[model samples]
Target: MRRPRAETRWAYVFLLPWLIGLVVFQAGPMVASLVLSFTDYDLIDSPRFAGLGNYAKMAQDPKVARAVGNTVLYTLSHVPLAIVLALALALVLNRVTGRAAGVFRTIFYLPSMTPYVAVGVLFLFLLNGQAGMVNQFLGLFGVQGPQWTTDPDWVLPGIVLMSLWNLGSTTIILFAALRNVPKELTEAAMIDGAGPWQRLRAVTLPMISSALFFVVIINTITSLQMFDQVYTMFFGNQIAQQSSGDAALFYVVYLFQQGFQFLHMGYASALAWLLFAVIAVITLVQVRVGRRLVYYEAEEHAG
Candidate 1:
């Protein structure tokens, strides 16, 4: 069943473009960035070796601490809610056995496909302090709407809400996972006099744990890199001096400010490395924890 040498050569030839691209574009830049992280490299001047200066400064940087805190807060607030909401929607859609379900799925997914800038703009207008639709709706009930973008206390919540608006993709992913759950298992549970909740707890959920874990990992990675919405909504003149109590100041946004806005390329590279480290640790932890929960029908098949 082994390939001939000629076939193997052809396979490698086909992969040559990607291999070359990795070296030239991906690997080259990554290595360069690592090197740059150790130096003080302003765009206008040659990089000077500074060893751990950038990292040392990071430990003492108030802005970096604030950005990290905000990012963590946003992730903790948004990811769990998004996962639950998406899974609930997906479960509902999975039970619908007609064209209506398909239409509804597409409608839900449409927002995720829409451009981030458009979503940011739409939310900004919708959540505007005095004139926004959300506030106006609240006014009808005599409940004053908080300044979502401008008030520090409300800024992170606004960003978390905005992030939830694109939960369609997660819903679709969970829907697919739910569909793959074997119906016979649920029927067996029902035959044992199990109710709906019992069936789901004993059968459906365990079957889809792998997919759920995957979604959590993907969401964590995405949340750590959140930038476009914050940049589009609050960067520069749009950001009031003390907007949202600085709640919207995410880690990636701070990195962007350091590298592009402040021209602290070296420092930004260090921050990028730190972000990578955090993500790596988190992913490892997820994998370890998931090992206990993830189930595979293939294992039963093999056994």
Candidate 2:
């Protein structure tokens, strides 16, 4: 039987605001950016159609390559570490209960709510080269700490360290997943002579695989777009100096410079599209690979 027209009309009425926002704000700009990527628009002048010229330039751009390399390195360094740390925190918290667990959970999550700019500035002071708190602490043990913000070799690591502070959100998600996992499986595994590590590997991991997959995907996307922390800590308002800013010039940072600072709107649009393509491909690969690993409890019940 066909649904009544009046009811169908009311559903569309309720969805109108979202539909309008999607078209006007999200989908509209995506389409416009794709078209603009083929042109040479400097925001002031008219966009002259340059066909594939922008893409050809990107192919030979050394800075583009550097930016992409930096982004990939940052993603690799931060994502896996963040996931592991978050999962470990979740596991620890899973064993706790009552008022103490609530207090601990809030303490852990508080850092995630701190503004990125504030955290960046705070870390710059903490990780200072000579007079910083970090180096001073290291000096107590006679270990000289490297210049975190200024040195190229240590800048990425510094950023990764800051990234760890935001693991509260990931930990909460994984903690919920751990709670949902069937305890009977782990109990049975223990009864069969499985040790703690073996039970964790065989039972707990498979049960929470879906949550693990979600964390991996989310972290990958966020790490690739890391800009605010680097901007505040390394490049805000100051002239770009090779010793300090070069190491922190991430893909989004470069794109921001090209679009707003340099006024190369067309080139920036191309960069945006290229990043979009990369993200699309990575997400697709994750979904493909996830098919073999991520387990759904509903599917098990159905089987």
Candidate 3:
């Protein structure tokens, strides 16, 4: 069946604004960047056609390797911790109901709404070595804290801790997914003498596996793009030099330095496209594995 021409025209008319915005905002800049990636443009004069020079330079750049390693390490450290903590919060939130549930949910979510710059500053203060709040707390237990901001060994871990401060959104998402699980399934498992751990393993987790998968993918991308917190806390700070700034030199931050700080516009564009490709490939792999692991209610019904 086909819609009437007048109705179809109205639908397109309603979508016109968004379509125009996409062409102008998203597609246009992407095309321009793609063209720029093949040239040598330093934000002044004409873009010299350099062919594959930018990519070749990127391939041989040691900073690029360091940035990629730091990003991967951060992602590994943060993603699992975020997923576990978020799921734990979701489980706790799942046990509450009514007004109390809403209050707790709002409390858990507020941190995610905090400005990244402020969060970075707060974390820097808290994680400071000698007299900061975190070390001060640790000192109560007769432990001396490492210099998180000035020591290379602890700096990356400290940044990971900072990133975990904004897990409210992930918790809320997992909490919603947990809520959607049918109570009947868990009750049946309980009736069969399944313990709390057994029920969680057999029923709760499988039911929420899709949400876990989503959180993993989203966290991977977000971790890869971490910049504002790092820049706010480390970039230009003298302590960062002592801390081995390479440990915090994440991919997106390096790209920003190239494009804006050093004015390597063309090289930055190439790096941007390479990052895009890496993300796309990784997402594809996750989706491939997810097909085997994710339990879909619709698929069960269809089968």
Candidate 4:
């Protein structure tokens, strides 16, 4: 006990820099932002307390509603598709062996490592309506691809499709989870005359449920906060124009325009807080759901 306690004290000493950095950076900004949420302040002017006035304006702001709607739609379209695709790829890769599998894994993962700006630019070129690869391919079948980024109807779908390029990390995580699943348990299930689907449902899924939960939560949070790709592809050079119409105005993009462009700092702070509340609630709900569905081997061992 004495030795462990001494080691624990040493651990704290080693962790001091990180703990201090968190307080100075993350916690400090969060508290400042919360305080700013109640105050009306342009960057130049002194902050004046507005209480809940900024938050109250949210209900009346049609643009806020539009941005939120766009964000929700994007999140709904992207998250499930990404998860399903990643899992399917992982399952396929898990069945392969040796150098060929390694080559394929590296090939798939390279896209995720590519810079977001480069990916956005690549997608824009590929999805362009006139001379783009996608439209040209569609023309071969007597069809036409929509102007992906320009047309409001197709912009969200284009963004979602672009987002899939980075599913490599998710695939790698699920692949690791699949590998960690006990082969003995699978063999036992097979010996009991379980079919492929039955074995997957009974043994495979439950064992990897924790990893699935983790991926879902992470993807949910990421999808909700999406901004960079939308900006890079649509709004990067057009800050003054506020172009891209209703389809491209994601929640974070709107918040950026408010705080920086329009200089509505107070309202922007309120929007940030609202986003935080939404993320917190969704994460809490997911955790509660996960408790019922996620199988933790540590819990089994403890029991």
Best prediction by TM-score: 3
Candidate 1 structure lDDT = 0.88
Clashes of 1: 3
Ranking by lDDT: 3, 2, 4, 1
Ten contiguous residues with the weakest lDDT in model 3: 236-245
What's the true lDDT of residue 295 in model 1?
A: 89
Query: Which one wins on lDDT?
Result: 3
TM-score of each: 0.95, 0.96, 0.97, 0.92
Better of 3 and 4 by TM-score: 3
lDDT of each: 0.88, 0.91, 0.93, 0.90
The sequence of per-residue lDDT tens digits that candidate 3 reaches over residues 44-71 is 9799999999999988999999999999
Model 2 lowest lDDT segment of ten:
237-246
Alpha-carbon runs more than 4 Å astray in model 4: 1-10, 237-243
Error of 2 at 229 (Å): 0.7
RMSD (Cα, Å) for all candidates, in order, is 1.8, 1.6, 1.4, 2.3
TM-score of 1: 0.95
Question: Among all windows of ten consecutive residues in candidate 1, which has the lowest summed lDDT?
Answer: 236-245
Writing each residue's lDDT as its tens digit, candidate 1 over 189-275 gives 989999988987889889988888999999999999999877778874355535654667789999998899889999999999999
